[model samples]
Target: MEEEIRVEFTKNGFDFDEEEVILKKCLSFCINYKLSASDIVSSWDVYSLNRGLELTVRSSHMGAFLEQLQNEQLNKVREKESGLHLYSNDVAMILDGEYEEVKEDMLDTPTSKPASANKQPSDSTGKISGSKFSSGKPQESVTPFGQRKSKFAVQSSLNENHIKQIVKVEDHTNSEDDIIKRVRPNQKCTMRIMSSQPKPGCRFMYDRIDDKFNFLENRIKKQAISYVSAGICDEPSDPSIASQKSIFAVGMICCEEEGRLKEKPVLLQSSVEHSGGQRVRLDFQKLNQFSVFPGQVVGVEGLNPSGHCLIASKIIDYVPLSVDSSDDHPSKRQAMDQNLQMTNLSLDVPELSLIVAAGPFTTSDNLFFEPLNELLAYARRKQPQLLVLLGPFIDSDHPELKKGYMNCTFDELFQLEILGKLRDYVEYMGSAVHVILIPSIRDANHDFIFPQPAFDIHPADFNHQIHSTPNPGTFCANEVKVACCNVDILKHLSAEEIFRNPQGGSKHRMTNLAKHVINQCSFYPLYPPAEDVPLDYSLAHEALHILSVPDILILPSDLAQFVKVLSLEARNEGERQIKCICVNPGRLARGEGGGFFAEINYKGNPDSSSASIIRI
Candidate 1:
């Protein structure tokens, strides 16, 4: 009731009294008449309009108004029916002479604007009520309403040429001995994007369920073929059909209801080629152990006696070997071996040194790029050969951006704060340094899709040293294959997965979480992608495929930062086990404080190659 009254008073541009006697009287009237606060406030508005009373509520007029209200109700009852004795004449007499008296306390003019034109109801300190205090949590600059508004500011108001002004640290020599000497100091490592990245400003919206189904169906079919080719299972059959004998079936794991996965009522959705995309109940109760999520496509040797549920005898969660999509016939380990060949790496040889950092690069309090500047300063001193920066560069969820408080557009912000600084860093660091940028879904200036498009900004003028790739991207540094996805898949899968301990799978929780990406063979395997990520199904099928396991997997996540050299053993005889170095560089600036960045010495040899997660 008070909340409603507060809103009305705020809208009306009236000062809310400290003692709140007027507010108390309004509450009293509501209790007596069993009316809502809005109704009572509306009556007060009508009273003010009728009598030409001052807009502000006064104590003297408040009591008389209450009496007048009671009298009006009694009069209405008397006119409608025979209820004369139910009302009291004493209440009607209260307004006889006191109605003449009313009054002020203009309360002085407010320091800030106080009226209907106000955008956010709450301030950083506290909420504003009427011209005073409002009830609720104090709000930061950001609002929940993510209205896609463009033309935030004109070009004249923004500094578009800030990229030219980034300065290098004094006494910072660009010579060999000046570089930060390490175990594997530095070397020539060319960065090449491997995946078919989405173009900047490409379409990702208006996707229907069919587009989504097509991606899932394609995955199931591919997995089925892989299982068969690897000679691990028989030809795939429909689990939905009735069979007394065990059959080789390939399908995706799903829940019966539209919610989190539980043990019972698990369902398997077969591909269109085999089961016409049919869904059947999965009875895992008979099986002692298993691990599955909604989007995982698996081969199962199982029986469906009643045709309603699949009773599994053995489940193949992962395809032991991978087929090179580029090749017609498979070469077990030749392709991967060729990619990993860095020739020779002695202790004295110059190795590839890189600094990997993710965003929002600025602190939440302001967009000053202090943390980013610090990172660049550190990078310049270190003089790393390669620099990989991921985005939410101009974060949409940023308080200032969401509140529309900045004097420039999102594009302008990115140009000034991120791209500008990066261009400067490259120029100062000289030709030896190359930068690889990957966009995030939260990047306001770029396309907000999971298989996100690269930033539209051109970097040819910067000696072609700086460039961008789509989210969930794969690239090569020298001969070392690096696959990096800006999306927080570890956190996403952690929230959605029904993880159970399978045989020989017990390890670090972080490793287990990250292994899902490699084992599932997709950058993002969550069926219904996280509520926050704008997973574009049309582009995801082509973009999300991890065709060849990368030598280094950069999966930046909100989870705790680590540098793990994971050993994924090949399940098939012909294929060789892969040792992948997974690095979550963490965010350079976490919330309002500094976080971490990864300094990678990519020897491309897991035994020799090592990474350290250093605090900013």
Candidate 2:
């Protein structure tokens, strides 16, 4: 069998001269599992090997053998791509792969050369020669939305073009020195816990059915009335009142039954309680283009002659932004002026830099927080005025945690492993660097509820530099109102969303997901939250609402990280559309390796602001 496997591998262009032992092991395992040597060899190629192999064999031994082969193949790719060596046993487990036991050690060491050292320098046009951070130089100013620019191509050296541009902007004013002098080294900023907490005498319980129903009704009314006033839809009427002829009706889309998402009948419930508060079955066979998720308040034009079914001819999702306005609209200009004034009054300088990262701080293989440490080191180097870190600080789903393999309690592990490192970080960076910590539902050491309380850590020795906020937290930094939520809403929405026209346009799915969040004006707007999320409907009324559109919305998700400028038009005409920067700074750790974070230099305007997604 080994001989046959060798012959098949040779025919398939596999070079196993230096891996005879591994080749033999693979052959024996394949034979034992009744896997065809020819079939296995056919799946082997230069491209497949370089990209990494994912083969399923019958047993654990076969999995280990395949992992070894994958490691060798990945090494070949790495060597060809960067002339770097991947030592044996330096296997990184594919986070989304089938095998759970395979752990890959991160090969990038502290002594490794910086990414910028290999690159040639470029001119002062904010471009870097031989840099892979971006495909091309970013515009001298911000590019308009819909242009797909690379998000994660940051240079290792501090002298990159972004730094140069910021320095040039700073050089035009003589206020830098004065601003630095005004900011005391160890000053602590106050952090307000935005989400409502259950008081001492209140009973803790899940949302009642009535409360949940009322919440959805309120949301539908607010959105339906906005559409009517905007002239997008006629005055709202009960769906049951519509005749067989074409008519317009405003209602909320929902499934007929709960916990049944696939191939289930969809119903449209009218906004008005009068006319018996009717629900009409929706028929979508005629609509040309549409995307609808449960709990969406939409305007539909169709015929409901029988008062039982509405055959929808057109679906009108509320327009997120008006295309009529330019980047320099008069209302926008006025708002910018106001922001500048507020910024000047709030701080010593008009500009502020911020670093944002979300956690599962430790890698999958072990409890060592190499990624978190590297992030803090980078933060210290940048010395941003504010650092925002979102959680699952003590991730509840970690392999070690799930297996119950630990020497101490969950709280002890949190204090020693999570907070200890943070305490040291703030102490080293000094009090001028404000640290904002937001909790998550998956955090083991904290409350498991959705509208969670802030971490109650009172270190007598350290100053109030470390600020803890609730799960869906909000705060102000240098006049910028920042709102952040740690739930993976993108994944939740994507899984449950039904798009009638999947290939409709050039708009990215992520952009549409963000638009839904902003238009709905709620943190977790999905009616029936994902099972993993612990949502409390009572507190959700006050806690989940976005009081006003925030300047920046930080929604960390399991989806691909993105930094986008979302422009939302106001309901009133002639008023400027609200513009927001939405960022999902991915997780800090993916499996057993470092991931990415974001940095922003806000100068009171989205166009003038500069931001980047950098790998740890």
Candidate 3:
């Protein structure tokens, strides 16, 4: 057999023209070696800077031929300065001796070593047979993530006997004998097939391909258990509430509505109590006959248990949920038929709402303006009445001018319309919304300089509209109160200016600080009220309390890390109170790229002794 030397180039983020130069350089190096068509085995490929070209020889003796060619070329480069420069600066030859071992097995047989069943590397002198070059070291085998696997580890599991067994199984598909043969644990094989087998003399037919292909079906089933634990069970309309035989009954109901399937009503039974203040259960197997839709918030009546899920024999109706909106009419349809609603809520509705924006705006629009608009729009439509703006909206560190695409200047941007426009926007939106501005590091009065009025605000705008003072704080919305603070001391000023500042040289630092604060509040845990400290109680009540606050709290997006930290805290608190903390569906859905707003509208919570239909 002959040899094949593939030429490849290596470059990272190289422009189109630079690649062309590398190709030309490699050609020049080959010509200098006085290599000819007959001497060349086949083709030489070009790889980028990072990926090198591979050379394969057609015969064992070809290794010597390649080594001779490499030396001849190096001699030519050393002769002329121009050639030397090209060799040193542009092209480098990979020595042939290093590939002496590789020259054996990889080469098409008879001429070199014969192929082996196992493709692991073998001991070869000063060379590698089937190895990959990585950072100057030869790797045994590389994982999908590019890390090398152990060279001594077993490379292949299947043997000739296994291959023969697999062939036999394939030929006997759908036959009882075939099914038994495939599942025999001691049989030599690379794969196992499992399925419910029919009794002897009983006729049975199955899709053999599906059974064979889905060999690891049990493994797949085990993996899906987590999703089930995460409450990803199927839901339909008018779910059943009772089972034919349920010991701890929640309730029972039949579906007589239009397009409904008439079957045995589901029995919702559970061993866990509604520790979240309601009578909720852990399992709904008894209620499986019920036609509970996916979004339905059904109740279960059951006793407590340990280790395993409690069984709920009865199903309670969904709960009533609504959002506070200032507008006279609801904008979207609440999911009433099932249990998913899109009700809009008010910022002042005694439930906590938040709007966060920060300064030194990197986006096209000023940082404060966008969030302010959202707050105002949300307030007007769903008047919760209270709105909180977390922190620094104006940036004093961002530059005003660009020298070119690469050069920028933040010196003059704050003195221009940037600060003035922000103040006006805040005042305009503040008339209808209650804001609690948290000062950030980039604040104008905090070391970084800015015009005096830039931090000043009209007293009328600060009156009942902002939460800048201490104590239990101030409240514009019912049942919800807010407190505001700054990252640094620039006190005795209106709360509105904390988030509104000009951009400057230290803009990046300021932005990061403001983000930290916002994220903290977003994921703040609800410390349990002492009265609710039972060991088995769920944290649902406390979580709902935090969520139910109507005040809109604003913070920076950069605080995402702190928010995650807070989530961990919440999880811990929840574990102590409840056996397991039910993750907020809204939060989970959003993490999965679902829409921002989640709404729920329930008919009402059913009386503990009975059950009723609640439209959500």
Estimate the overall C-alpha local distance difference test score of candidate 3: 0.26
lDDT of 1 at 160: 20
Candidate 2: tens digits of C-alpha lDDT, residues 1-616: 7777776555333445335665667676576445666545533432232233322222334355566556655655644655322121122222224222221221234466666435322211112113211223233222221122433456222224656687576565435564564354633444444554533223446679888777777766766655654567676667776585788777777888884232367888876453455788998889766777777778888888887888999887663333211225557746865775475467454356788899888776556555676688777656678889998887776666554433334665566556777788777777667788888877776667776666777655564777777668788876677888889877676656666443323235565677777666677778778886777777676667665667788999876777777766575567666778788888887765667788887776565677777876
255-361 in candidate 3: lDDT tens per residue?
22322111222222211221111222244445433323211223444433442334655543321123211112333323331232222232322232233223332
Q: What's the TM for model 3?
A: 0.22
> Worst 10-residue stretch by lDDT in candidate 3?
579-588
Ranking by TM-score: 1, 2, 3
Candidate 1, position 498, lDDT: 52
Which model, 2 or 3, shows the larger lDDT? 2
Instruction: Tell me the TM-score of each prediction against the true structure.
Output: 0.68, 0.65, 0.22
Highest TM-score among the candidates is held by which one?
1
- Better candidate number, 1 or 3, judged by lDDT: 1
Instruction: Give the alpha carbon lDDT tens digit for every residue of 248-301 in model 1.
Output: 899999877776563236788999899998998877656676777778888888
Clashing pairs counted in every model = 5, 3, 113
Better of 1 and 3 by TM-score: 1
Off by over 4 Å in 3: 1-352, 360-384, 401-432, 445-456, 467-616
| Candidate 2 least-lDDT 10 residues | 123-132
